[model samples]
Target: MFHLLDIKKHDDGISFDQTVDVKAQLLARDPDIIDVDSVHVVGNISFDSGLYLLNYDLTYRLVLPSSRSMEPVAFDNQLFISEVFIEEQDVASKKELVEDDLVLILEGDSVNLEDSVVDNILLNIPLRVLTEAELENEDLPSGESWSVLTEDQYQALQEEKKVENNPFSALNGLFED
Candidate 1:
Protein backbone atom coordinates (compact mmCIF):
# COMPACT_ATOMS: atom_id res chain seq x y z
CA MET A 1 0.00 0.00 0.00
CA PHE A 2 1.31 3.42 -1.02
CA HIS A 3 -0.32 6.12 1.00
CA LEU A 4 -0.05 9.48 -0.76
CA LEU A 5 0.59 11.36 2.46
CA ASP A 6 3.23 8.99 3.83
CA ILE A 7 5.54 9.39 0.87
CA LYS A 8 5.13 13.15 0.48
CA LYS A 9 5.54 13.82 4.21
CA HIS A 10 8.61 11.70 4.92
CA ASP A 11 11.70 12.89 3.15
CA ASP A 12 13.60 9.77 4.06
CA GLY A 13 10.66 7.74 2.76
CA ILE A 14 8.83 4.79 4.36
CA SER A 15 10.16 1.25 4.47
CA PHE A 16 7.97 -1.80 4.03
CA ASP A 17 8.78 -5.42 4.78
CA GLN A 18 5.91 -7.84 4.56
CA THR A 19 4.95 -11.33 3.47
CA VAL A 20 1.96 -11.54 1.15
CA ASP A 21 0.39 -14.87 0.43
CA VAL A 22 -0.45 -14.98 -3.24
CA LYS A 23 -0.62 -18.72 -3.67
CA ALA A 24 -4.05 -18.63 -5.22
CA GLN A 25 -3.07 -15.86 -7.58
CA LEU A 26 0.05 -17.71 -8.68
CA LEU A 27 -1.85 -20.94 -9.20
CA ALA A 28 -4.42 -19.14 -11.31
CA ARG A 29 -1.78 -17.76 -13.64
CA ASP A 30 0.28 -20.91 -14.12
CA PRO A 31 -0.87 -24.36 -13.16
CA ASP A 32 2.65 -25.75 -13.55
CA ILE A 33 3.62 -23.85 -10.43
CA ILE A 34 2.05 -26.20 -7.89
CA ASP A 35 2.39 -23.92 -4.91
CA VAL A 36 3.69 -20.52 -4.00
CA ASP A 37 5.11 -20.96 -0.51
CA SER A 38 5.50 -17.29 0.28
CA VAL A 39 6.10 -13.92 -1.31
CA HIS A 40 8.35 -11.49 0.57
CA VAL A 41 8.59 -7.82 -0.31
CA VAL A 42 10.95 -5.30 1.21
CA GLY A 43 11.43 -1.78 -0.03
CA ASN A 44 11.23 1.94 0.33
CA ILE A 45 8.64 4.18 -1.30
CA SER A 46 9.94 7.71 -1.60
CA PHE A 47 9.18 10.87 -3.52
CA ASP A 48 11.69 12.49 -5.80
CA SER A 49 11.38 15.23 -8.39
CA GLY A 50 7.63 14.86 -8.96
CA LEU A 51 7.91 11.12 -9.23
CA TYR A 52 7.41 8.39 -6.66
CA LEU A 53 10.29 5.96 -6.75
CA LEU A 54 9.61 2.43 -5.66
CA ASN A 55 12.72 0.37 -5.10
CA TYR A 56 11.88 -3.03 -3.77
CA ASP A 57 13.35 -6.50 -3.49
CA LEU A 58 10.84 -9.22 -4.17
CA THR A 59 11.47 -12.90 -3.40
CA TYR A 60 9.12 -15.80 -3.73
CA ARG A 61 9.34 -19.51 -3.18
CA LEU A 62 7.50 -21.66 -5.66
CA VAL A 63 7.08 -25.36 -6.26
CA LEU A 64 7.56 -26.06 -9.97
CA PRO A 65 7.64 -29.14 -12.13
CA SER A 66 10.96 -30.51 -13.29
CA SER A 67 11.52 -30.33 -17.04
CA ARG A 68 12.16 -33.99 -17.64
CA SER A 69 10.88 -35.92 -14.66
CA MET A 70 7.77 -33.86 -13.99
CA GLU A 71 8.63 -34.03 -10.27
CA PRO A 72 8.05 -31.08 -7.98
CA VAL A 73 11.08 -28.82 -7.67
CA ALA A 74 11.41 -26.01 -5.18
CA PHE A 75 12.52 -22.76 -6.78
CA ASP A 76 13.39 -19.50 -5.06
CA ASN A 77 13.62 -16.43 -7.27
CA GLN A 78 14.70 -12.90 -6.37
CA LEU A 79 13.70 -9.89 -8.41
CA PHE A 80 14.75 -6.29 -7.92
CA ILE A 81 12.19 -3.63 -8.76
CA SER A 82 13.19 -0.11 -9.77
CA GLU A 83 10.02 1.59 -10.88
CA VAL A 84 8.75 5.17 -11.09
CA PHE A 85 5.13 5.94 -10.25
CA ILE A 86 3.39 9.00 -11.61
CA GLU A 87 -0.07 10.33 -10.86
CA GLU A 88 -2.87 9.49 -13.25
CA GLN A 89 -3.16 13.10 -14.30
CA ASP A 90 0.45 13.02 -15.43
CA VAL A 91 0.01 9.77 -17.33
CA ALA A 92 -1.14 11.24 -20.63
CA SER A 93 2.08 13.19 -21.06
CA LYS A 94 4.35 10.63 -19.39
CA LYS A 95 2.90 7.55 -21.04
CA GLU A 96 3.72 8.77 -24.51
CA LEU A 97 7.32 9.44 -23.58
CA VAL A 98 7.99 6.30 -21.54
CA GLU A 99 8.19 2.57 -22.10
CA ASP A 100 5.35 0.44 -20.77
CA ASP A 101 7.37 -1.91 -18.54
CA LEU A 102 9.31 0.67 -16.56
CA VAL A 103 6.73 3.13 -15.22
CA LEU A 104 3.37 2.52 -13.62
CA ILE A 105 0.68 5.15 -13.29
CA LEU A 106 -1.00 5.69 -9.96
CA GLU A 107 -4.72 5.57 -10.71
CA GLY A 108 -6.41 7.14 -7.75
CA ASP A 109 -5.42 8.43 -4.31
CA SER A 110 -2.79 5.71 -3.79
CA VAL A 111 -0.85 3.12 -5.74
CA ASN A 112 -0.36 -0.59 -5.35
CA LEU A 113 2.85 -2.38 -6.37
CA GLU A 114 1.22 -5.79 -6.50
CA ASP A 115 0.47 -5.72 -10.22
CA SER A 116 3.96 -4.68 -11.21
CA VAL A 117 5.50 -7.21 -8.89
CA VAL A 118 3.32 -9.89 -10.46
CA ASP A 119 4.42 -8.84 -13.94
CA ASN A 120 8.05 -9.15 -12.96
CA ILE A 121 7.35 -12.55 -11.49
CA LEU A 122 5.88 -13.68 -14.80
CA LEU A 123 8.91 -12.44 -16.69
CA ASN A 124 11.29 -14.33 -14.43
CA ILE A 125 9.69 -17.71 -14.60
CA PRO A 126 12.28 -20.17 -15.95
CA LEU A 127 11.42 -22.16 -19.05
CA ARG A 128 12.61 -25.32 -17.40
CA VAL A 129 13.32 -26.27 -13.80
CA LEU A 130 15.99 -28.91 -13.32
CA THR A 131 16.99 -30.08 -9.86
CA GLU A 132 20.40 -31.34 -8.74
CA ALA A 133 18.84 -34.64 -7.82
CA GLU A 134 17.55 -35.01 -11.36
CA LEU A 135 20.93 -34.15 -12.83
CA GLU A 136 22.80 -36.65 -10.64
CA ASN A 137 20.84 -39.59 -11.92
CA GLU A 138 23.03 -40.63 -14.86
CA ASP A 139 20.14 -42.59 -16.28
CA LEU A 140 18.45 -39.94 -18.43
CA PRO A 141 16.22 -41.82 -20.84
CA SER A 142 18.39 -43.85 -23.17
CA GLY A 143 17.65 -46.67 -25.58
CA GLU A 144 19.89 -48.89 -27.71
CA SER A 145 19.56 -46.58 -30.71
CA TRP A 146 18.77 -43.19 -29.18
CA SER A 147 19.46 -41.41 -25.91
CA VAL A 148 18.73 -38.13 -24.22
CA LEU A 149 21.36 -35.60 -25.17
CA THR A 150 22.94 -33.27 -22.67
CA GLU A 151 23.17 -29.57 -23.56
CA ASP A 152 26.79 -30.06 -24.58
CA GLN A 153 25.86 -33.07 -26.65
CA TYR A 154 23.42 -31.09 -28.79
CA GLN A 155 25.90 -28.23 -29.17
CA ALA A 156 28.59 -30.67 -30.29
CA LEU A 157 26.15 -32.22 -32.72
CA GLN A 158 25.41 -28.85 -34.27
CA GLU A 159 29.13 -28.10 -34.63
CA GLU A 160 29.71 -31.43 -36.33
CA LYS A 161 26.81 -30.84 -38.70
CA LYS A 162 28.11 -27.35 -39.50
CA VAL A 163 31.49 -28.78 -40.56
CA GLU A 164 29.88 -31.61 -42.52
CA ASN A 165 27.65 -29.17 -44.38
CA ASN A 166 30.63 -27.04 -45.49
CA PRO A 167 32.67 -29.94 -46.92
CA PHE A 168 32.45 -28.43 -50.46
CA SER A 169 34.00 -25.12 -49.42
CA ALA A 170 37.32 -25.82 -51.20
CA LEU A 171 35.45 -25.89 -54.56
CA ASN A 172 34.04 -22.35 -54.06
CA GLY A 173 36.92 -20.79 -56.11
CA LEU A 174 35.65 -22.61 -59.23
CA PHE A 175 32.41 -20.59 -59.16
CA GLU A 176 34.05 -17.28 -58.05
CA ASP A 177 36.57 -17.19 -60.97
Candidate 2:
Protein backbone atom coordinates (compact mmCIF):
# COMPACT_ATOMS: atom_id res chain seq x y z
CA MET A 1 0.00 0.00 0.00
CA PHE A 2 1.37 3.42 -0.99
CA HIS A 3 1.07 6.01 1.71
CA LEU A 4 -0.95 9.14 0.87
CA LEU A 5 0.87 11.16 3.49
CA ASP A 6 4.03 11.61 1.41
CA ILE A 7 2.28 13.24 -1.54
CA LYS A 8 0.16 15.27 0.85
CA LYS A 9 3.31 16.56 2.57
CA HIS A 10 5.45 17.34 -0.48
CA ASP A 11 4.14 19.72 -3.06
CA ASP A 12 6.77 18.64 -5.54
CA GLY A 13 5.74 14.97 -4.94
CA ILE A 14 7.39 12.08 -3.18
CA SER A 15 9.84 9.58 -4.67
CA PHE A 16 9.76 5.87 -4.09
CA ASP A 17 12.35 3.25 -4.95
CA GLN A 18 11.33 -0.10 -3.57
CA THR A 19 10.17 -3.65 -4.33
CA VAL A 20 6.80 -5.17 -3.56
CA ASP A 21 5.24 -8.61 -3.73
CA VAL A 22 1.76 -9.44 -5.00
CA LYS A 23 2.12 -13.01 -6.18
CA ALA A 24 -1.33 -14.02 -4.97
CA GLN A 25 -2.94 -10.99 -6.52
CA LEU A 26 -1.20 -11.61 -9.83
CA LEU A 27 -2.44 -15.19 -9.99
CA ALA A 28 -5.92 -14.01 -9.25
CA ARG A 29 -5.72 -11.47 -12.06
CA ASP A 30 -4.38 -13.93 -14.65
CA PRO A 31 -4.46 -17.66 -14.25
CA ASP A 32 -2.00 -18.16 -17.09
CA ILE A 33 0.52 -16.10 -15.14
CA ILE A 34 2.19 -17.98 -12.33
CA ASP A 35 5.22 -17.99 -10.09
CA VAL A 36 5.49 -14.22 -9.84
CA ASP A 37 8.95 -14.05 -8.28
CA SER A 38 9.17 -10.36 -7.48
CA VAL A 39 8.13 -6.92 -8.56
CA HIS A 40 10.58 -4.00 -8.43
CA VAL A 41 9.08 -0.52 -8.80
CA VAL A 42 11.05 2.69 -8.94
CA GLY A 43 9.21 5.97 -9.28
CA ASN A 44 6.97 8.39 -7.47
CA ILE A 45 3.56 9.94 -6.98
CA SER A 46 2.68 13.55 -7.68
CA PHE A 47 -0.43 15.62 -8.11
CA ASP A 48 -1.11 18.94 -9.70
CA SER A 49 -4.25 20.92 -8.95
CA GLY A 50 -6.00 18.99 -11.70
CA LEU A 51 -4.88 15.37 -11.49
CA TYR A 52 -2.69 13.00 -9.55
CA LEU A 53 -0.21 10.94 -11.54
CA LEU A 54 1.68 7.79 -10.80
CA ASN A 55 4.69 7.15 -12.99
CA TYR A 56 6.84 4.13 -12.42
CA ASP A 57 8.92 1.42 -14.02
CA LEU A 58 7.82 -2.12 -13.29
CA THR A 59 10.28 -5.02 -13.40
CA TYR A 60 9.01 -8.48 -12.72
CA ARG A 61 9.23 -12.14 -13.73
CA LEU A 62 6.49 -14.69 -14.17
CA VAL A 63 5.87 -18.01 -15.86
CA LEU A 64 3.58 -17.98 -18.88
CA PRO A 65 2.36 -20.76 -21.11
CA SER A 66 4.04 -20.74 -24.50
CA SER A 67 1.51 -20.01 -27.18
CA ARG A 68 2.71 -22.87 -29.41
CA SER A 69 3.94 -25.70 -27.24
CA MET A 70 1.81 -24.93 -24.20
CA GLU A 71 4.92 -25.34 -22.04
CA PRO A 72 5.86 -23.02 -19.24
CA VAL A 73 7.91 -20.03 -20.36
CA ALA A 74 9.41 -17.51 -18.01
CA PHE A 75 9.78 -13.85 -18.85
CA ASP A 76 11.61 -11.04 -17.06
CA ASN A 77 9.89 -7.91 -18.27
CA GLN A 78 10.61 -4.22 -17.76
CA LEU A 79 7.71 -1.90 -18.38
CA PHE A 80 7.04 1.80 -17.84
CA ILE A 81 3.56 2.67 -16.59
CA SER A 82 2.13 6.18 -16.35
CA GLU A 83 -1.40 6.49 -15.07
CA VAL A 84 -3.57 9.33 -13.82
CA PHE A 85 -6.02 9.07 -10.96
CA ILE A 86 -9.32 10.94 -10.95
CA GLU A 87 -11.48 11.57 -7.98
CA GLU A 88 -15.21 10.73 -8.20
CA GLN A 89 -16.07 14.36 -7.70
CA ASP A 90 -14.12 15.38 -10.82
CA VAL A 91 -16.08 13.00 -13.08
CA ALA A 92 -19.37 14.22 -11.71
CA SER A 93 -18.27 17.76 -12.44
CA LYS A 94 -16.75 17.01 -15.87
CA LYS A 95 -18.72 16.32 -19.06
CA GLU A 96 -17.28 13.16 -20.54
CA LEU A 97 -14.11 11.09 -20.85
CA VAL A 98 -12.20 11.83 -24.03
CA GLU A 99 -9.56 9.96 -25.97
CA ASP A 100 -6.19 9.67 -24.23
CA ASP A 101 -8.08 10.27 -21.01
CA LEU A 102 -7.89 6.82 -19.51
CA VAL A 103 -7.73 6.98 -15.74
CA LEU A 104 -7.95 4.98 -12.53
CA ILE A 105 -10.44 6.38 -10.11
CA LEU A 106 -9.43 6.43 -6.51
CA GLU A 107 -11.84 5.08 -3.91
CA GLY A 108 -10.18 7.07 -1.21
CA ASP A 109 -6.97 8.91 -0.34
CA SER A 110 -4.48 6.04 -0.73
CA VAL A 111 -4.07 4.13 -3.99
CA ASN A 112 -2.88 0.58 -4.44
CA LEU A 113 -0.33 0.30 -7.20
CA GLU A 114 -0.44 -3.49 -7.32
CA ASP A 115 -3.28 -3.73 -9.84
CA SER A 116 -1.67 -1.20 -12.14
CA VAL A 117 1.67 -2.93 -11.89
CA VAL A 118 0.23 -6.34 -12.80
CA ASP A 119 -1.84 -4.88 -15.64
CA ASN A 120 1.17 -3.39 -17.39
CA ILE A 121 3.13 -6.58 -16.98
CA LEU A 122 0.34 -8.62 -18.56
CA LEU A 123 -0.05 -6.27 -21.49
CA ASN A 124 3.65 -6.30 -22.27
CA ILE A 125 4.05 -10.08 -22.29
CA PRO A 126 4.94 -11.50 -25.67
CA LEU A 127 2.19 -13.29 -27.55
CA ARG A 128 4.55 -16.13 -28.25
CA VAL A 129 7.71 -17.36 -26.51
CA LEU A 130 10.02 -19.91 -28.10
CA THR A 131 13.24 -21.09 -26.55
CA GLU A 132 16.45 -21.11 -28.60
CA ALA A 133 16.50 -24.89 -28.41
CA GLU A 134 12.94 -25.09 -29.73
CA LEU A 135 13.92 -23.08 -32.77
CA GLU A 136 17.01 -25.16 -33.43
CA ASN A 137 15.54 -28.61 -32.86
CA GLU A 138 12.95 -28.42 -35.69
CA ASP A 139 10.89 -31.01 -33.87
CA LEU A 140 7.15 -31.21 -34.42
CA PRO A 141 4.51 -33.43 -32.97
CA SER A 142 3.28 -36.11 -35.35
CA GLY A 143 0.47 -38.63 -35.01
CA GLU A 144 -0.73 -41.59 -37.07
CA SER A 145 -3.08 -39.43 -39.15
CA TRP A 146 -1.83 -35.89 -38.77
CA SER A 147 1.37 -33.99 -38.16
CA VAL A 148 2.17 -30.57 -36.80
CA LEU A 149 4.19 -28.29 -39.03
CA THR A 150 7.23 -26.28 -38.08
CA GLU A 151 7.29 -22.53 -38.73
CA ASP A 152 9.35 -22.94 -41.88
CA GLN A 153 7.22 -25.83 -43.20
CA TYR A 154 4.01 -23.95 -42.47
CA GLN A 155 5.09 -20.93 -44.54
CA ALA A 156 6.27 -23.16 -47.40
CA LEU A 157 2.91 -24.98 -47.48
CA GLN A 158 1.02 -21.69 -47.51
CA GLU A 159 3.02 -20.50 -50.51
CA GLU A 160 2.46 -23.79 -52.33
CA LYS A 161 -1.30 -23.68 -51.64
CA LYS A 162 -1.59 -20.16 -52.99
CA VAL A 163 -0.06 -21.23 -56.32
CA GLU A 164 -2.33 -24.30 -56.53
CA ASN A 165 -5.47 -22.26 -55.80
CA ASN A 166 -4.91 -19.59 -58.50
CA PRO A 167 -8.11 -18.67 -60.44
CA PHE A 168 -6.71 -19.22 -63.97
CA SER A 169 -4.90 -22.44 -63.03
CA ALA A 170 -7.66 -24.60 -64.59
CA LEU A 171 -7.12 -22.95 -68.04
CA ASN A 172 -3.36 -23.30 -67.64
CA GLY A 173 -3.85 -27.00 -66.79
CA LEU A 174 -6.16 -27.62 -69.83
CA PHE A 175 -3.60 -26.10 -72.20
CA GLU A 176 -0.81 -28.21 -70.66
CA ASP A 177 -2.92 -31.39 -70.92
How much lDDT does each candidate structure score? 0.80, 0.76
lDDT of 2 by residue, 1-177 (tens): 555666667897877887888788778877887578869999988876546789998888878876667778787878888888776677654435423467666788776877777777767877767665666776776889999886889899999999899987778757665
The deviation in Å at residue 100 for candidate 2 is 4.9
Candidate 2 structure lDDT = 0.76
lDDT score of residue 58 within candidate 1: 96
lDDT for each residue of candidate 1 in 1-177, tens digit (9 for 90 to 100): 778777899999889998876677677887777887669999999997668898999998878889888888897888898888888777666765456555676777776767666767877888868778877875676779988987988899999888779979667779765
TM-score of 1: 0.75
| Model 1 Cα shift for residue 58 (angstroms) | 1.9
Best by lDDT: 1
Best by TM-score: 2
